[model samples]
Target: MKFHMLHRVYLLAGVSYFATAPDVLADPVSLLATAIQGFLLSSTAIAATATGAIATIAANAIVIGGLAAVSLLGGRRGGAIKPSDAKSTFEAADSSVIEGIGRVRVGGMKAFGNTDGSTRWRLVARLQGPIDAIEAYYVGGREVVVDPDGSVTSPPWPKRSGGSWMKIEDKLGTGSETAWSALVTAFPSLWTSAHRVRGIAQSLVTYYNPGLTSGTYLKLYQAGVPDTEWLARASKIYDPRTGLTAWSDNGILACAHVLRRDPAFGFDGFDWDLIAASANKADVLVATKTGTEKRSRVSGMWAWESERGATMQQLMDSAGVVLRMTDAGKIWFDLIDDVPTSEIDFDPIDIVEYSWKSGPEAVERPNICRLEYYSPERNYDMAEIDLSGIAWARVQDEIDRYGPKYLDIKLPFCPSASQAQRIARRMFALSRADSGVMRTNMVGLAAWGRYYGQITEPDTGDIELVSLAAPEIDDEAGLVDIPFAIWPTLSAWNPAVDEADAPDEVPELGYTSDIPQPNAPTAMVQVVYPDTSREFRIGFSLTGTYDLSEANYRTYTGALPNGWTAMTEGTNFAYVAGDLEGVTVDCRVRIFNGEDGSPFSEILNGIVAIDNTAPTMPVASSGGIDAGTLNVSVHGTSLNMVAIRMRKRIYNDILGWGDWFDVVTYAGRPMQDLNFSDSAASQEVQWLLQCLTSNGTEGPGLVYHYTPPAP
Candidate 1:
């Protein structure tokens, strides 16, 4: 149902009754639908979107074995991360590096360690550099503010037995670090001038305790306690455009560093000039909540160790970037942006044959993306975030009609909340708009420079946008079978300005231990039936003792929202009455006490009360000869409009094209008649006829061959 509706993989390792839960006594189908929203369920779900998903079997189900979170499509070292792979922080065991751009918190290797056996102890940490700068320090898993001179400010240091304090000496080394002269002076043989440690961010920590007993001194000195951890900005990378290195968190700059730095992980000894030029023009593109900011910039971070490809993917996912690999093995990347990057403007003649395919059903699609990630703001520990202000997404009436749906995902290497939110927003945008696949078969040179995945449908009169594809070729048949995902172009959405702050995750929405149902916010929904479409309007209408002003309603569509929006600072939520166009279906109001749902007032015009079935494929006429022209007839239950298009072919060569035209049907006709004229000079044509309801839903199309009689 849509008045106009509005709309990630999240990693929810132990997703405890996540998202919306329907009442236990509810119908089994409703219960299953609610369960499908929060978890990355198996393929078989409650219902399919295109068809009525009574029990749908999905094609894409997420795998979150461990990692309270890790990004989508999994990482490179063969497959996804498993439970056995979960461990303590990588800072303790791995040597960290910052590639591309962005700021990150890193732990370092102890290059030097010395203890005087009584009063003093010294240790040196070495970091990969020359880096941009050390921004902050995370000592004991907490970010601590520091002065320019390396003195801790916020958490005042605690003293030892002899009034001695810990202190740090930092060398913000851009390959110009000097030796520890004082350590050399105190113990010449142990610490020397050769320990300059140039080209690395170096830190020397000292602990001195003058008056301690033997046992106390040994315990304090031998303990594995560490000093301040370093959070530094990554150094500039080579921009093929500038012929120099510069500071940037740009996707191309990041991906380039991954590909050219070291022989072990880099794709060195190859020509990247073409890739670099593509980057110069395309790297700046980024995902936008507005769907208008084509040159929107994105950012990412890397502080953990992983396979080389995984690192590259994190950068791409963080920036909502699209990396296209060609059959020729050439690598190209672009942002999940609104801008059209394709070279050729398409014409219908390019499509020799085409068929429409439905994307994941609403049951399979998750509206809320519970994205888990590590945050630099939280001292490099795990954090979760989502997006709510994104426009033109699946924030439609479904969330209010069904229940909350969730797609739990993780960005293992992503550290910024804003970056994580961008990726989550992209998931929602693409899932809502790019769900259908157009299986287009063509035999032409029109797609010479265009990627197989970047093509759009040729017919302009359809209700779709630029189509997405996963490429396959029928080499023997001499056809490129490009199954295209119907992707709505951003510019077409004309997305409204969304300035609301994307709601941040607030300590698991206050649910801890055994979940107690919230004793408030029983909601009501008005199911409006217009001529063709169903519009559902919902809001919490202050019942019981729960104050309407203080209550925050987190409505679930089928999944969790990309981000959660609560009653922050008295935010005004828009409301609609339970009746539209003065028609009401007698039913029970929806109950959302916890994150669970109740039954809807089920009513269908001219159908059973509990029906949610879709009209099947329509039967169309084979273009029989009548009145000196070809006659076409389309049949369906709730018959709508007939979309007809034709093209001519002769001698095994396809010729000119005909744009799609819709024949709107009127009620009370036993059968509808479609008339075609000769304004465009119809010849022997391949006629494509499809059905579109007034609400703009489509069914499988029918094809026929027709020839016009001479006038």
Candidate 2:
């Protein structure tokens, strides 16, 4: 069973129940409180109390595998010992680095024989500092404090007779009893009894923190000991490995020399595969080429530039590494991958042109189109249409006649009740045509829209009746209301297929319904050029002609034309000018199923330039030269206008080109709030001003610079 299932079973089964005898009944209040505590404890895995009492268990109680307790040890305490009092007055030790204003002292390492039968190592660090210093020890032992009379107070430990020392396990060395013997295990042939003596002497420094141990260990391994007496005491340590011992000293140096400096430079962060594939080159040109200036700079890397304006070719003749800053602001580091046997060079402009030409290839393909069909009554009414059938017979016929990619079709008028069936029939015909060579994806079905709020038919049922009614839905019970519908919810959805052999995973279909749901009253749509807002309208009169001015309630106050009625009013559609005012007006229309009041078709797939706001120019209100500084005027509306870019330019030879500044940018906020003022005196602002004011020094001559503020 699953873990959760087992837990549930245990909870239900472990709960005990008891019945009270007639003579003695349990206390109701106490029992109820106990029950609540029991439930909480069992469900939450926490210890709980009923009347504010605690519970105790055996020493071996299994409280669960993952519980831990906080240590009673608190924060660091105290003051340091002065360096002047290091000798007689304080307990003195050699090489112990101590600190403190008061005379609190701590002893360094002390060697001792391993009297206990636990391990072969023995070393103890006595605590001579204040009482709080005991908390810093890895393994705490007996603590002793000396009074003014030199009397001692010894603190007892739970276990005594044995002191703690970090044990070093040995498996591959001779004379293993001594520390020096173990240190030389890396090179067995060089070991001797004298070397074991040195290991003992060096062990004191080795058994400390990493920084102290690393520095001392490398010195001992490389230079042996500094004193001749110490060297003479352990001269047997000398071996052929002594000179090459640097490989084991530092990680970075070891890896760089032993690995990368080899014949095959094994650097990690480079593209090794590409380097290996290039026939005659040790390094491949992996940088992405962008912009002419960067390419020119990279090509002239080996050349020198003089303060007198001498060009690269005029100063140098050999190749070298060059760094070029690309127009797109990428730093390209060019290295000497291979040297040419003969003299080789190219003009900067020529190199720039070559770099530009070595980019990716562009391809051209035929255009493709997509279409959708919707019905009116049933939520889902379309049936599978034979793709080879008459779906786009008329459209195809027209296409074949005029030999054009675009075509349209008009269907015979049908009543709202049978609209679903008619649409399904047309969908099947189009599907049938799709299966053939003529791709029918471009065609779309537009369910005829209704005027007013109700759809009608003539008495004979042979002629369709159209009426103009109120735009308000409540007033359209007897009038015409446009309705839309589609079929096979999942049929229109296409799943992306995996290029490899992996099976495609099915995704859950998010909320979508055929039932009528309320939609926003004022919805927007967009359309492309030639289809202006004023020229677009949806209506039905058994003829293709319809006037939009006669359809809107406000514009058609006199009366709706022929079979139309008012449904609702307001700015449903506006011209390009409306879009310029930070508004989006779509020219697409929606068809609704009047009965359910739900959308039954696509989102019209309108094609309007969503970015309609024109680019704006920046107006400087005040920021150009106040108190020897530039206090210019600047004020702008629609500053984020997509089409425009704002920039400032200045010239001042006193400061270099490195000092220029721009406005601050934040989401939907004024740039002035982040303005730079001369009085501010910030290092960054000052440097930027200096750079901007300077001309012909690392900066182009007085050209306007545009920089978008950081997000």
Candidate 3:
């Protein structure tokens, strides 16, 4: 049997060994070579002899073959057995071709080869139990176990009689029951291995789920036992079928776990207790249960779900928290609106590059005429709020002008709509507020300086009032800007006062200083006639060199035909006369410097005229008539230059008089009598005349009739 195994090994190595006699040599080197050849020949002879000597081991031919093959490969590769080659040979050999089933001899085989008998048994034993155990276990039918050698086996059924049957009949039911008990004894170790395999499978399946991070696959692999309860929980947490909550919760838990585990994310200083307290105040749960906080109570749950590729930072951003690294290299998680205690300034020197855009595109102003907020705690589902009446009227006016814009924001921990609305409105106002960017290159102007307060440009005298948002800066780039709120300084003007004094004058003590002789007062005189009365008055506006109080004024030469007298010695003076119509008067002002004894001042002359009446209408008298023409005499007013207009029409005709024509020579002239010729036609001709005075007054009309002479 050993010989057969050695032959099989030789066949596996693809080589054959045939014993042959070596020729004897006299020389030493040739003798040495001949001896070595003789030794190999002897080894082959022994292998053949041993194969014929052990027929009982023939049934274990395959195992023998595997060992022989290991021996041959070891001999070729410097006398060391390759475990991989042995395993492959054992796995590939046909068990059916071998005659019997029993462990093959592996010890004391110096003639055949040096084989590791212990290692060979261990590999066989390691594979043997699972095969035996699986065969022993049973379900509806007896379970079958397939061996690595391609042999299948099943455990025997319980006997109906004898001791085994009696034992089975008394307590255990059948052989399958006994086998199952044995299998259960070894199930833990087996289940652990199976669980690890399942974890790998699950990770592969969920690799494409959104919000997956670098450590997600590791987490999935570490997930404990697979059971219905665990699966249900996993489905609730990660199943997209459950809607945004599941995916979001998964992402949140994933990020939370990552944050908790990261050494740089200073969870040591995080106030979990405070977060718990604040979360509990909501009366609804907000904080999610985490692996690190298993024992702590969670009052709420929050999910952050987005597209499949969303990053951990993006999820945290959606939660309205900022994740930043501190100067000490620790991570800080803060509310989006939290203001830093220190101020930050980013000057032009600190910025590398920057751009700004403002208009309808940067900020959308919506009308928002009405505001309503969801209120689950209130009696009503929603509560109405006033937007226009708020203090942010300027913001509202922008909204009103632009049109209504709607935004629904979720405030996770807010207890009531009132609170939520206040926060929402504040956030909205901040969002719509003015923002700008100023790039600078100053390194000391860190991001902290942006919130520090105002930054002033000393050179330009331009000041940025308040920082609206955080500054983005880092050591490498050394560039940043006070992003959001910026108000430029207003320009102003200053005035200077002149420094000077006035001189003083004194008057004589007892007697008033001799009144200085008054200069002639310039006078403007206008004659006005009152419609209510026939009286006329001269209106005068006067400017004098001396104070009017020190001067006495009087109307001088050429006052009206009547004895018109001046009423007062003031800058404005008037003289009244009842019968001054059609008269012109030369008026002058005489100013007395002081009392009656003072000499009169030089006269200031002005002219005033009154002509309140219009001229009388002209009278026309007919003269001798000639063929087709007639001569007539016309008389007009004698007070002033007079003009005449004449129109002709047939006597007793219903048609109105023709257009008037001016007596050109008599127009605006001082003539009272004028002769004119009019056309004499087949019927009688009538003449109508009206007169206008030089003062532009018009009088009533007069008519004259004449008959043309026969041709």
Candidate 4:
């Protein structure tokens, strides 16, 4: 709750580009196919212009926006083009049935078939609802798509659901083809096919049922598929359980064919090669060759030694990578070195745990992990650690040690809480465990600058707003590099330029410094954008130090010359500016006890000095001792002018401050020039000879004079 003062001055005119945002958008040229067509006309132009990127990939991904007009309009058209066929029904004739509740059967069903005697039949049925409020419901079916090539062809048979569901079917010619078919239908909406549907069903079971693994689900698919059809030969499933999406290709034509269709899942499908060239694109396909050659390679061992007191290896060994651990032991891929190979693939995702350690010297180290391939994508993740399920003791300890360090910068304009959270969080690689951990409801941090303005912390009150001033032509006369000192609250910040004819009372973004305040605890801080009338938010948690409303008494004032004009003033603050040489300002501030209205006793009172006096002319210092020396130095009459003061800033790492020290106030000895043996031979002595003849009135100001120090 402590308040601190920060006075930053920015030179108005300088660089061609003003503010440099922390995030660098992804290669714009890389946005092709679905991404381009999806985000093109929406916020694409604005994002492109503002970020100066050609393609819309980075802009579309990071920028908060409404649905693209083209998409919305197309959706409307699609609604109009609503399939000529609406509802669909599936009928199969099977003999064995459990009539009372949900039934199970094995033979003679059109969609169901018995390939092997020991194989079991599974039935799955679903109900597809309306276009808008429609929801898909699984009805139930045992066998489907047997003799799929002969029996099922073209548009394929309608799934046991409403017509709203699109029907797609792919026949597997071999075991590999079955796998490939399953992969194609993994995500129903994204891809549709009988094999894919079967694969998705198995994936669903594996994810939801603890005892059921992907193999168990696959067994059900194998048992249900009719013997009349050919099995697939190649197919790789993209695991959705993990954050990363990696694909595998068996060197078989199926996998390669799918990839060759669109290398990066439609990324290269677009005609734009510039984007493909600019983007980070990679494809890895491993296969067994006819003959094996002996080779020696260096195995890489990346050891993350935790200065925070624990090693990643120990944590992983204990926790394991699976979401849930059971008595059967943790489920994770064991590192195997069966083949005489040199290099083992290492990924950051493979890391299991990290421990926090701190020292008396204020140093903190946490043993975390980095992916060998994508080192930039490090995660604080202890592979199997579900931070949500962590013990309270550990969580609290983390909260105490690190304060808000884990939280990313939350901008106000982001679309949703999730987007805001993601933006706020540093990428897993950039995450530092020692930094304070903050709880967030979602992933990306929202950048809603229009709502929130700059944040301020005054000396005697809770953190408040010091509305940033509308950029004006300073005497220096230059376009203000705004971010040099003041940062906007949001990324899509569109500030309105004030007009010369506009009334001062009107709150124009660029010209008026009108900062808004929060109305309620839940109400976000909203500010009218300078450029456009649209309002934006400035983000910050209001519950922290300002939990209560308490007034403080402070007798503080800045020492400024009288000639300067006071642009604005507040109950506890005021701003005045003028040409430094033309003003003679004196300002002082003192803190006092509010209850008694008396000066509060402290180590030292707050005082800022200002000198508007011009450099005075030097005088002839004839100490009458005529033999001692004629020290020609400026001897000022006023105490303030006696010591010419200037402010010097030094960076203080320990204190997290740029220490602004008063350079002139030091009680050190002054530099003296004497018309003696040494001074007589120097330029200083030559000045003195001229000064003695001119008598004080026509020469430089002698600020001060003193005797030589004891050598």
Candidate 5:
């Protein structure tokens, strides 16, 4: 519910891209194939550009929006994608599934799987969606090319009529999904016209039950798949210019797609035509890559499972794309390149009311930017490049003047270091320019600009490029307030020209600033040394943030007012023994940047701190059956984590165990949400059973790795 305020210049409440989101293991190129995580901010707001037909309510209202610093770069944070479960059919139905973007290979969770007597079985697995198409499907970890007739074509299967083989079917998961023909034919009572899995990309396999032996007799069904993998071209984007939906890693197209599908934004419709035009414009403004063929200035893979606004912001910021709504309540997309013309050139004296900020405060603006990216060659792990010393960027002189610390930029989708370097340079350049924001409330509506325009400074009279502008309506005041942000030029970002920048005279201070010391350490806390060890005595870690300047860090601790002495030191981050000799009550940390040291920052005000680790493995198994209902329990003990939720399912001898189901949630005494759904069983039914987490996401191993004592 809280919003992140970027320094003093602007504050983001609802619907801000620079907003802070939840701790999640977001996708890194190949997505959930790896548990790599990154952070995005959170907030509750109306749709970004598609506020739909309703722009204003009744009387007095605030249309929350405007251009703010896109908080793109920072250190990676915590999170988890939905765990890949082999028995997903038995999983909770309400749990939000992982939806993907770009090219990805992820496991599927079954929504439903059933059988017809002893001969046939059907498994419907829903992968993250609404996806574009499946490029390949794997069974038993091997690729199988499925023919259109639903027969196994490439892997070669018996063309037997008595259900001796398997056939595969796929649905792109649109809003309107037709029920499977085979399922409807075999189980007409259960799979009727109403049995549609809409908005979920699903793959269904109709084959001879894998469980049957030559006479694979006794077993009724097999719940376990040898292995299932789906590799596909995820989320196709619609190009307004081309009027076509195709496979593209275009960040703008990606943003457009998610916004359209995610109804949480509360928009009746969108201006797709406008978005398409802007995307076309963005494509021409290229950032050069050494050995790659890239057509757009910004394009990258994204597999985010977070807040809708925050996700959209990632696509927009990564490509320098901007979204704005005009006073007429129409949405417009603007690319941050060169401005060819002004919608309305404004001079301060003519405006009714105005607030002009030249840019961010001196201390807040960054002189150097360090871009971290996922490299394909590095197996999608993170890598970094610096954006200083480039002639077109902030340069060494600027660094000497302002570079006390470097900004952390993450391009989770940019796979090339060279491309990352180019984007990082532009970001640093944009940050350094006088990013003036003009908040003027004018009486006449026509005075406002539709897109990028020009603003004449009150004192200097110099023209600037308007980067963004969002118009606000104040019906009571009878005035339209449009706040616009601008750069100090009329030229677009040119990679070729900027790459050739090499200043003749360099400052003696070079890249190092003259500041006496570095900033105090940040994200300082205690941690468990060997993760999952549960040994709290090993760590009081310091995540020393100023990587560009600091050489190392020093820690001192002592009881309340007693004397403080050096405890230890670390180059970038440090983890030291807790419950140690001198460590007590107060923990003080300072950074030494080779030249000088920073002021000590006090942390852990007596209360000991420990880093958040994975939830403990399910331990202490206990199960019993009462009145035909099976009850089983497992517990994991850890100081850093708490069990956020719990679920239960029933075990099947043949089909294995079904997915875990959550307790019904409603509202009661205080009328709170998430109250239990059902109090008792409706009829002679499926018995209840309980289970838990999978690999990597919850533990170093299977969290609920348990078999209840034989009943």
Candidate 6:
């Protein structure tokens, strides 16, 4: 007789269910509903039948000494089972328990017996209504009832080394080593039953504190066992050579041990087979991807240790995968870059309401420009991978404008900088992609069904989905589809356009007195004679004004001094000759504004004193100091109209020449003799004089040196 080979190459090893025959026998029926109902109702009968068939197959294999190859049939195929059917089956089973209880309305109860053949037995039960207390009793021994607030009325258990049973005020407080030891010691039946003791403690703690984590439960459970023994027991369950168990209860203890022992074990390779094997050995289901896409091998080690400890979910995140559990308690893995395989469309007709939001807060840019990892064994640092080339400009621009937004991840497991950089790049890319999140809302379930799946808006050609709500639900329908909240894909978010053609506003026109002439409060105005058709070149200071090319011309208008005239040529204004000494003239200028000339500036009044000639130098008469007094005479052609200034120096035979004395002056009064009282004891003295015209013009100086009487 032909028989199906039970062993599947893809199935993980050490699965005992398929040791004899095929794990799942082919059901010879097409109607799924009937098959499901029959299977559920007569599961025991089916198991017995399969056992007998397996025995027959085993006998035949012994005789033949070789197993024959048979076509493999995929396990049960159909749409997901309806939740109502499963719920009804569960309710029916619960009803059977209720019926067995008969008239005694036991609120809740649990019993435990020693598997190690001890005569001791333990039972914990909650009394109905008025009693309002949970009681724990040993067979043929004393019973203790505890109030909801952990107030115990004389516990039957004795105190342990670290803690006391009588002192436990709450379920959460029972996680201490002494408390756990007290519970096990008080009830000897739990001495050899680790799983039972853990379950009972977890139930109690969860009853008191619903927020207690599975990790916390494992920690509390392991507190009673020695580290060596715990490791040995955990290895037996999570080594893969042994059978994998459910991830809860004792299995959680095994997982915690392995994680706490070697946190970087998962990052050893890029192969999913190894990762899945490790997860399976730990009684965790880390789903594998079935595709031809190239996989990345991580060479570095990733290590983490915290007093609060870490969850398996955080481990999955470190490995760059999202952890999701199915309804059957199986695990699923989704890559960070995995896009939705299907799209859902929600048109305006199907949507009852909608909302959307986008702003600067949602914008994300690359933060990490490089990645570095250290290797202690190598005694030297690994080569640095240059991430500056990847989106360098964008990352730099963000840093330049908003300071450095760097994310430096410490990955000790990374054997090389290249691999660490790859991980960093992946994180950077994901962050950048998530930065511009466009959250939107719509009504109704007429869209794709899956968390993180894509949804297309027919009205605006936008694709969105509720990405924040994962594992629990992926689509708007799961959230009742009323005002479905979703986020737009990074590629679908349109950035604002940059308007480059718009010009900046022009500044107002103004001027200042740039070049001030002597005795002139305004800018210098060059006077020219028109005898040879000469023009004066007057330069003016201007600001808040455009370049010459940008402006048409400068216009000049002023009150001329008889022979002077002003005219606008180009940027410069031409002025005819003007012998206008002591004549004040008012002048103003306006610049062309493309369409029309600007308003004339405020009037600038300046006296026209076109005297460019310097005053004649003063002459100093030669003289020698005779009685601590030196006298000198200075003369000039324009001495009456100019002030005389003089400086004197004294020279001694030993001290050389003394510094020039302070300048002395005579106001426009031409002095025949200039006198200075010499206080210095020097052998020689020198005097220098200069003349300044009334217009403040200074002439060259005349120098005279003479010997002074020795003191």
What do the candidate models score in CA lDDT, each in turn? Answer: 0.41, 0.21, 0.31, 0.20, 0.44, 0.32
640-663, model 3: which lDDT tens digit per residue?
Answer: 323666666665356645555444
Superposed model 2: Cα runs more than 4 Å off: 1-615, 620-625, 628-711
Q: Each candidate's TM vs. the true structure?
A: 0.48, 0.14, 0.25, 0.18, 0.46, 0.26
Ranking by TM-score: 1, 5, 6, 3, 4, 2
- Decreasing lDDT order of the candidates: 5, 1, 6, 3, 2, 4
TM-score computed on alpha carbons, candidate 3: 0.25
On the 0 to 100 scale, the lDDT of residue 586 in model 4 is: 29
- Give the winner by lDDT: 5
Which regions of candidate 6 fall more than 4 Å away from where they truly are? 1-314, 338-353, 359-366, 369-386, 392-394, 412-419, 434-450, 464-711
Name the lDDT value of residue 55 in candidate 2: 19
Better structure of 4 and 6 per lDDT: 6
Best by TM-score: 1
Report the error of model 2 at residue 262, Å: 84
Worst 10 residues of 3 by lDDT: 198-207
lDDT tens digits by residue: candidate 4, 519-554: 221111112111222211111112222211211111
- 688: Cα error in model 2, Å: 12
